[model samples]
Target chain A: MGCEEFELLLNGYIDGELKDPDLKRVEKHLAGCPPCQKLVRDYQRLKEVTAEMKFKNPPQEIWDSYWQRVFHRITRGVGWVFFLVGAVAVAGFAVYEFATDPAVEALQKLIVFAIFVGLGLLLISVIWERVKASKTDKYKEIER
Target chain B: MSLTEKEIVSKCQRGETEYYEQLVNKYKRSAYFYALGMVGSVEDALDLSQEAFIRAYRSIKRFKPQYQFKNWFFRILTNLCISHLRKKRRRRVEVSTEDKEGRTMPLPDDHFNPHLLLERKEIMRQLWKALSELGNKHREIILLRDFQGLSYKQIYEILEIPVGTVMSRLHQARSRLRVKMADFM
Candidate 1:
């Protein structure tokens, strides 16, 4: 191949991506061409520079943001769960305040607190259910 | 280098925004480097990356679910880089057969000391001076194939051109780069 032809195929040949016939032809030409040989060598070296170039990782927070973004998305789903539980708990508190007097039992406050804890756990469970409910592939197809 | 192309597209089309970020973060460095390499500015790289992501997000709807995600992402990035380069109207010197000696590839400047980093930063000032100095067609082909590691077929796919065009452009691009880097050799 002359300098012009060799110049056109030099890169493809260096990358080992030329068609078979084209490859052999380029190889045959390179066997006797000084400029083409030099061209091939230079392309190889430049490819090396590219290959050797360092791979820099993005910042750690980017990864964190990846999961955090996912988690935050889940959090919004959980928010409704919390809202429901908080509402029930508030209602229970209001009922207790208006219904029997506080002096009814020594353990009354403790029982009420325990009920609130249960209510909170129920809220979390509900959130988990909602997340599980939407975990289907069909819903996964939906974007925010 | 990434999830199989189909899987990526399906995941994205399925409204997998977070899954798409994997694509972003995966190629972020290359996208960033290409932008930085071509535009010779970090600000441009940042802008280009954002633009690439936004563009990718918007047009992803048109992407066939059967295509490769990396290739598709690269298509967006390279085009953005090209467009970004065009809008700014920069020039790259045609790399010709020149004395390409002693252009030692230092460890990438990411590891340099603050002072060296400054020097390295300035290095970009003249670095793209070589590549940027090339003609427009030569510039795009070279940057896409060499710096971007795109296959001829992939280049054709991305650019929507014939494979023959990819090969010729690649050859010209590499020749030009060799000429530009000739001084360093």
Candidate 2:
């Protein structure tokens, strides 16, 4: 194989992933080729430098409170779900009571009902826009 | 005797939530450091890593027993870091110089030579700066292999890519990194 072909396998060679014929071929090429050898040296140096670089360890308090923080987040998520459900239930019952009350005027009920319909439509519009944006966003694949 | 990871995961699957603490404790440093490497900020790394654990716990039932837990957790953590990077890209806000300077790795106490310590710190800082400038794929491949010390097969498992792709990607990433660190080298 020529240099270009061996170039592709050079990484595997350095990483010890090459075997048999491929390994022998790279070794033969490396013996004859200074550029390939230089490439190998460069990559090895990069690896060594990266190996020496480490992030500073976080404070002990972060570790001590780690599990507790996660647990609180989980419980808080559940709490928010319950709270939303209760809120919607209470609002629905109140709306039902107000609409059915004989003492309430027809115009007052109509105005209140219109306000809710407008709010619901606004919510749906916002959700639809977000879904559309998410689908077409150019940065979507960055997360992949 | 300490329970194996599989046994702990089994207990967690069986509704014993307390067993999960063991998994979290075991992998927290790995998770946090990986996040720190990707995001280049201490606070964001801590928050993102903890968020990944919360996400893993929420979906624990979907975890297949045949898979290694570290690889699975890393996949989740990596996705979070990538997504965080995506959002940061959208904002177009540069990481402040002070934040970067504040994150130097701790030098060993035995290295009492002041000049050597300063030189090492400078090299580390330059290395990190180069790393942060890389594209997401390049940066992540380097981190998974060089810094995290994951084997090619383990990297393939975590990345859900073929082994050939892993090697090629690592080579490309290192090449780009070499260009970035040309002055230091």
Candidate 3:
């Protein structure tokens, strides 16, 4: 292998990562090249030295508490949001289908009215909650 | 199919949520260390890794089993830590608490006497600093190849990069570290 190629692949060879053709070239080059041989040895020595450094694992509770707050609660809220949206979408589709169909006019009006009432109540609750939340935000965020 | 980690991951696609604890436990140490290596503190590493795991767990439902879970989760952890570090730097109110001895000493000298153990600790600290100073890509590749002991293909899979990229990055990372060995160890 050329000195350039050997330099490129030297680390891999030390890690026993060099494949056949490249490995062959490196071996052939090492047989004649003292600098290349020293380079390989030094690479190995450095790797061994650094390998002694150990990466530390984080403690267990931080992961547990952090995720629960960041993701668990967030997902739980988002899950409800998704369900509400899906329920609304499907209900709207059904009501439209029932109303627009000649054979289902009775079913359509009843379902549509039910959806309207339910949606109205839900919107009122959501609006009230949001207003309350905004009032809290005004209080809490104002401090910042 | 190379019977990729994707296969195991796909199995986790839904019911996978229940089994996620397995994946978390498996990656917990290495993932934590990788984060620790960058953030430079046990506390930050712990916080970051935990956060990383939670993010991974939250998105477990969307994880495709046909893909390798190793890379999938690691990418999330890597992204979370990097982003957290960026935001953290922005909120940089905490002036560094200087090591009390660092002010008067060179910081690496444990003693004037010949103690191999002290020397080894100094070496490890140096290496840790060297690894931390590497650019993010080099740091990730070294963690994957050396610390995590991933094969070339697996590193590529984890990185979602070409094999050539993995090889070159690995080379770059090692060369950078090799040059910094004195500073590191």
Candidate 4:
């Protein structure tokens, strides 16, 4: 194998992931290549040091409440969904009643209708802005 | 009695929400450590890992039984961390007000002092500093293989890449780390 090809197999060899025939081929190349031999030693040492470095364990209290926190999040999520839907439905009904009521003055009805329209337009604008921001957001597509 | 991951998932799918506690208890440490390694912050790691579990619970029906629960759950987690990192970089760029040829430049995270979490050994601190300096992809492969002790095949499953890709990426990642730790060597 040429140097490039040997270099490709070096990782596998160091990782013990190479099959016997490929391992033999790599060993044969390393025998005549001092640079590749040095590279292997360096890689092996790097791996050893990395393996020895472990993350510190978190406190037990975090573990104790971990599941409870997740449970609360799930419940809170469901609650928010219900709350938003109910709020929207109630607002829509109130607006419809106010707009259709014949007992109210003409100016009063016009002002109420205008207020609802303004609120509706504001909501749409905010939603549109959010959608546009998400489109341009660099983090939108992460590697799966 | 201990249940297999698949069995636990199936029970959760059957509307037994309580069964999920078993799954959470089983993999919470692994999930938290994986996130900590990826994001370099303990608080964010705990939040992200738990969020991943909640997401998994919501989407368990989409998970085919052939897939291992751990791999399926980890995919959700990695995607979340990657997204979080991008947002964090964007926030830093905004705060620094440094633009290089119309592209935003992320500021170094000088505030993220991992020494509080890690032991005071110089080598350990150097290892973490070197690991944090690595790009997300390189750091992820190293964390999975070295820190998490996952096999290449398991990485292939989680990352949805070929086994050859895992080996090559791991090689590149470790080579970069070797360069970073040249002072110690």
Tell me each candidate's TM-score: 0.59, 0.78, 0.64, 0.83
lDDT for residue B66 in candidate 3, whole number 0-100: 60
| lDDT for each residue of candidate 2 in B1-185, tens digit (9 for 90 to 100) | 99999999989888788899999999999898888888877778889999999899889899999999999999999999999878765534332123466753332221112222123577676787788778889899999988898888889888899998998898789889888877766
Binned by DockQ into CAPRI classes (incorrect, acceptable, medium, high), candidate 4 is acceptable
Question: Which lDDT tens digits does candidate 1 get at residues B122-183?
Answer: 33333355555677667666666767777888778777889878888777676676677776
The docking quality of candidate 4, as DockQ, is 0.40
Q: Scored by CA lDDT, what does every candidate get?
A: 0.65, 0.83, 0.67, 0.84
Interface alpha-carbon RMSD, every candidate: 11.1, 5.4, 6.5, 3.5
Query: Over 4 Å off in model 3, which ranges?
Result: A55-144, B1-11, B88-120, B183-185
lDDT of 2 at B153: 87
lDDT of 3 by residue, B37-122 (tens): 66666666767776777766667778776656777778787787678666554433232234657543222312112221124476
Ranking of all candidate structures by their lDDT, best first: 4, 2, 3, 1
Q: Every model's DockQ, to 2 decimals?
A: 0.11, 0.29, 0.14, 0.40
In the range A1-144, model 2's lDDT, one tens digit per residue, is 688788879988877888899899899999999999988888888888888876556669989999999889977987999999999999999989999999999999999899999999999999999999875565553656
Candidate 2 off by > 4 Å: A93-144, B93-120, B183-185
Tens digit of per-residue lDDT, candidate 4, span B69-175? 88888888988988988878776665554566766556568523656445657877888889888999998888888778777777888889998999888878887
Residue A123 in model 3: lDDT: 99
RMSD in angstroms between candidate 2 and the native structure over all alpha carbons: 8.3
Superior candidate under TM-score, 2 versus 4: 4
